[model samples]
Target: MRQFPLEMHHMAPGRVVEWRLRSTAGAQSPGPDGADGTADRRASFNQDKHFTVAEESRAADDPTASWIAVTFEVAGPLDEDALTGSLLAFVRRHEVLRCEFRRLAGELACAPIPAAELALDTVPVADFDRTEELTRFLVERFKRSIDTLSWPLFTMGAVLREDSATVYLAFDHIVCDGMSMPIVVQEVERGYEALRRGELPDPAPAPSYLDFAEEQRSRYLSIDEHDERLGYWKEFMASGDGEFFPRFPLELGVEPGRMYSIVNEASPLLDAAEAEVFEKACLAVDGKPFMGVLAAVAVCLREAGGPGVYRGFMPVSERGRAGWGNSVGWFVNTMPIEFDASPGRDFEQVMASVRAGFGEMIGHLDVPFVRAWELLAPREFAARSWPYPVNFFSYIDMRKCPGAERHEDWRPTSHVWSAQANGACSWFQRDAEGLHMNSIYSDTPAARRTMDGFLEALRETVREIARHGSFRRPIALTPPRRPALTPLDVAAFARRG
Candidate 1:
C-alpha cells in the first residue's frame, strides 16, 4: 500500500455513508447492558505525552494535523448493517481503539473504554453525482470530524456503488502508526466477510498499547538528565556543533519561528522488478535495500552541496518484541545517524558506511527520543512543534508486514495529512508493486525547487545503483516534474494543522 495525500486519491462518484462510535452512556435501553467505564489511567509514553501536551498548547485551530487514514475497496454492493457490525468488531478487537486520552492533573492519561460499552452510529451523509464533489465533501468531513483533543478520535465512511464499495477509516496519530494501516485493512475485510456469512469475527485479543506504554514509562521515567545512556544523543548533538536537530542541508528559504502550509507529494521510483534488482544489488554489497536507499539519498544530498558525511533523523520501530508487533499505536522512535557520502565514494562504499551507521544507531535505541530531547533541549521541548523543521527520513519494507499478500487485490492506501511544516520529511516505502517515496515539506519557492531537484537526483541515483550496482557522480539532472507551483485551494490545501 502507498501513503499519499487525499488530494491524490481517486474517489468514485457514489452515495456516501459515515459510521462513527457513540458511547453507550445514558442509554436507558436494557437490550445490551454493560458495566460502567473506569478511570483506569497510566502515564503515556514519551511520544504520546509530548504530542498531546503540544496539542494542548497550540494556538492554531487548524485540525489538519489530525489524522492518518486508509482507503480500500471490497467487492459487492454496500451492506450498511453488516459493515457497521464488522467495523464494531474491528474496533473491539484492537484495545488501543477503545482508549480515550485526557490531561488528568497536568499529566496526559490514557483511559481505556470497555469494548462492550461502545456503540456504532451509521449516518447517511449525502449522494454526489461527481467524484470531484465527493472528494471535496469527504476531505472537509474528515478535517471536521477527527479531532486530536477529543475522545473516540476516529471516523469511518464508505462510498456505495451497485457493484463495489470504497471504505475509508481515519484515526488520530496518537492511536496508530504507519504499520497499523495494513492490519486495519486485513481485519476489516475479514470481519466484514465473516459477519456477512453469519459467522462471528471474534479473534484472539491483541496486546494492549496501554500496557506497552505503561511498561515503557515505568522503565525510563526514573532516569535523569545525566544518564550515561544519553551519550549517543550528546555525541550526535556535538557532531552538529552542539545543536539537537539537524537542519535540512540545502536552503528551504523558510523564516524562523513561522509555520507554512505543507506540500505533500508522492511518486514511484522503481517498479516491482526493478526494486527486486535493487534489492539484489544491495545484498551483493552486504547491505539491505533500506541502506541502499539511504546511501543514494546521502549521495544526492551531497551532490546538492550538502555535507560529505550525511546526518539526519531516522525513525526506528519500537515494536521489536513479538507481543506488540500486531498491536496498533505510535510505535516509533526518531534517532540520528551520520554516514560518509563524500566525493569519489561508490555506491557500495556508501552502502557499507550506511550499514555501519545504522548498526550503531540500533545499538543505542534503548533511550527514547522524547526523553533525550527533554533532557537535551528542554526549551524547545515546550515549543508548539519541533524547534525548526527537522531533517528527517524513514524507510519501510511493507512487503514483510501483515496482510501484504492481499495488497494487490485490496488496493489499500494509507494517507497522512499535515497542516504545516517548517522543513521537509521523506518516507521511502517498498511493497509488492514497487518502491515509492512520500514527502511532506514546507511549501516555499526555494524549498519547492530544492526538494524537487533533490528527489529527482535521488531517483536517478537509485535507479543507477539498481542497474549497475554503483554509479559515478550525478550527471546533469532532469527538471522537476512541475516547474511551477499550483495555487493551494480549499479542495487541495483546505485544512491547516
Candidate 2:
C-alpha cells in the first residue's frame, strides 16, 4: 500500500461512527513512589519514543503530531455490531493499543490497561452528505483528536452505506508505524469475519511491544558515546562537516530552524510488467531491486547538481526476529549510510557501492539513533523539529505483507499525516499494480520545483534501466566553456603533468 495524505483520498458519504476506547478507571498518575495501584512494571520509553516526546515537549499545542493511518473497504453492506466487536478484539490482540503514555518522575512511561476492563464505545459523530465534506472532516478530526499526551491516542471510524463501507483507523506514532497498517487491516477483517460466524478468531498470541522496548533498553541503555560500537557513527559524522544529520544537497527554500506546512504527493513510477523487468535487470547486475532504486536516486541527485558522495539515513527495521513481526510498535532503527556516486560511474558500479554501504550500516546497528543525536548534536536534539532539511528514504514491498492477496478487493491504503516539517521524506512502495513513490516535503516554491525535477529524472533513469540491462549517466553533448588560462597557469599545469 502507498503512504499518501488522507485528504487526497476519495471519501464516500455515509453515517460516520467512531469506536473509541473507554475505561472505568481513567488515566492514573503515578503515586509518590511511582506506583499506580499496580506493580511498578512500567516500561521505559524506547529510543524512538524518547526522541518523539522530546520533540513534542518543545512546544505546547504543536500542530505536527506524528501519526500513521490506514483505510480499507468491506463489501456488501455494513454490520455495526459485528464491526464494533471486531474493533475491540483487534485492539485487545495488540497490547500496545491498551497503553497510555504518561510522565512518571519526570520521564515518559507506558502503562497498559487490563484487557478485562477495556471497552469500546461506538459514538455516532455525523452523517456527511458529500465526499468532499467528509474528506475535510476526517482530516481535521484526525489532526485534532490524536494527541500523544492523551490516553486514547488513536481514533477508529467507519462510513456506512447500503452497498459497502469504508473503515479507517489512525494511531499516534508512539504506538504504530507504516508496517503496522497491513497487520491492522488483516486482524480487523479476520475478527469481523469470525464474529459474523459466531466464533472466536483464534490467531496466535501477539507479543507485547512494551516487552520489546524493555529488551531494547537492556541491550542499549548502558552504552554511551565513548563505547566502541559507536565508532561507525563517529566516523560517519567526521566524514561530513561534523554534522550528525545530513542535509539534502538541493535547496528547499526553507529557512534554518523553521518548520513549514508539508506538501504530500504520490505517483506511479512503473507498472507490474515494467517492475518485473526492472527486477530482472537488477538481478542481472547481482543487485536487489532496492539497491537499484537507491542507485538511481543517487545518480539523479548528482545529475541535478548534488554532491557526488550521497549521504543520508534510512529506517532499518528492528523486527529481525520471530514473533516481533506481528507485534505492533515502532520497530525502526535510523542508521546512517553513504555511497560513491561520482562522475563516470555506471549503474552496476553504483549498485555495488550501495550494497557495500548497506552491509556496513547494518553491522553497526548496536547504537540507537536517539543516543547518537543526544551525544553528537545536543542543542538540536532539544528542539521541536529538525535543525534543517534532512534527506530520508524508505522502501516497502507490500506484496509480501499479510492480506496482500486480497488487496484488489479490499482496496487498502495507508496514509501518514504531520502538521509541519523541515525536510523531505520519500517512501517507495511496491504493491500489485506498480512501483510508486510517495513524498512529503516542505511547501515552498523552490522545494516544489526541485522535487519535481528530481522525480522526473528518477523516473526516466529507472525506466531506462528496465529497458536495458544496464544504464550509464548521460553526458552533455556540449560541455560548458572553460575559463581562459594565463601563461603562468598553463606552465604550472604542464609542469605537473
Candidate 3:
C-alpha cells in the first residue's frame, strides 16, 4: 500500500482536502465490535476489504476523467449560511462521511471514523443546469470504487436558496442497499436540523459498518443455527442451472445516465374488500400479497415470453438486533423464489407454492445471503443464483414513507442510480397512502420497452388474479400519444428529448 501525503488543504470553513494512504494487504479488518473476525468477510459480501481511488489531470477530451460530482438547483431561494453549515455537520456526524484512504499490502482501502477530514467544495450554484449532472458523477464514482465500502456507497448534491433547493443522494449498492437508504437520509435530516438549531444531535447507537461486517462473519459461523436455511437453499438452488441471471434486458449498455422515475399507483385490488382478501392471502393460505406479487410477476414473465423457470429475488432486512433500527449499513439478504410458469397453472396454485416457500425460507432468514450462496451455490457461478434476476418482485411497507413529513426543515427527492450489477430489478412498496412500484431495467432501449410492456401485462395479470382469482387472456392495448418530429426537433429533442 502506498502512503498518502498527510496534507490538509483548506477549501472553505466547512470543507478541506486531505490525503489517504492505501492499504497494501487486501485483508479485511476486524469490525469495531469484532463481530466478523472469524468469517470470510470478502467471500460473504462478494466484495473486498479495500478499494481504490485516483485523480487524473483534467483534459479537454476527458472532462469527467478525474472525479465524480453532483450539483443541485435551489428550489425557491438560497440559504447558503444554514445549508452550508448543515452539510458540514452532516459529514462530521457520520463516520463513513469522513473517509480517509491508504494502501495496506498493495491494496487501497478507506478507514472509518466518527469524524472525517472535511473537504468541502462549494461551486457557484449557477454551474448546474439540472440535477442529472450530480447523479451522473456519483454513478461514475461508484463504478470506479466497485470493490470497497463501496458501504456508505451514497453521495449527495444540494442547491439551497431562500425560496427553494434540491438535495440528492447517489448510492452504491454494496455498502448500502435500497432498504437502508431511508435510514441514512433520516439521520442526515436529524443532523441537519440539529446543526440549524445549534444543538448537538443524538446519533443512533448501533454497530458501525465495520462492526456489521464483523457480525456477518460471526453470524455465518453459527452453522448450527443456519443449517436449516442452508439446507433449504441447497435444495432450492440445486434445481437451477447455476448461472447468474442476466441483467433485465432494459438496464444494459450505457454510459451511466440519470433517469427520473416514480412508483406506479397500487392495483385496484388493494381496496378494502380486496385488502382483506389480500391480507388473508398473504397470511398463510398461500404466499400473502408479498409472495403473491412475486407469483404474479412470474406469470407476467411467462406472458412476456421469458423463461418458464420462475425465480424472484426478495431482499429482507438483516437489522434484527435491538438499536439497529436505523443503522446505515448493507444488511440485506436476497431470497430466491422458484416455480413453474406454466400457462395452465392457476394463480391459486402458484400463490400456495410461494406462500409455503416464504414460510420455509422465513425460518432461515437469518442466514447471511453471501454465505448462503457460498454453501448452496457453486462458488464459480454463484452470481447467477441471486434470489431473482431480470424478473422478480419485492414488497415494501409503503404506507409510512421513512422520513419527517413536515416541509419545515428539509425537502426530500427520490432517484434511482446504477448499482453496476448485471440485471434488471423492480420493487413494489405500499402503505396507507397507496401502492407504488418501480422497476430498474437495463438501460438498453429494447429492454426498457420490454419492461414497459411487461409491467402493463403484469398489471393486467394481477388484476385478473385479484378479482377473478384465476388467469384470463388480457386484451392488447393501442399505443399512447406520440409527437411529430422534424430534423430540428431531433437535435433539440435529443438534447431535451
Question: Which candidate number has the best lDDT?
Answer: 1
Per-residue CA lDDT of candidate 2, range 100-168, in tens? 666566555666776666788889999989978998998889888887767687999998989989899
lDDT, each prediction: 0.79, 0.78, 0.46
**Pairs in steric clash, model 2:** none
Number of colliding residue pairs in model 2: 0
Q: What is candidate 1's local distance difference test score?
A: 0.79
**Which 10-residue span in candidate 1 carries the lowest summed lDDT?**
488-497
> Which candidate tops TM-score?
1
Q: What tens-digit string does per-residue lDDT give for candidate 1 at 122-194?
A: 8888999987788788778777777777767789989899988889999878888888888888888878888
Worst 10 residues of 2 by lDDT: 485-494
Give per-residue lDDT, candidate 1, residue 203. Answer: 63
Error of 2 at 305 (Å): 1.0
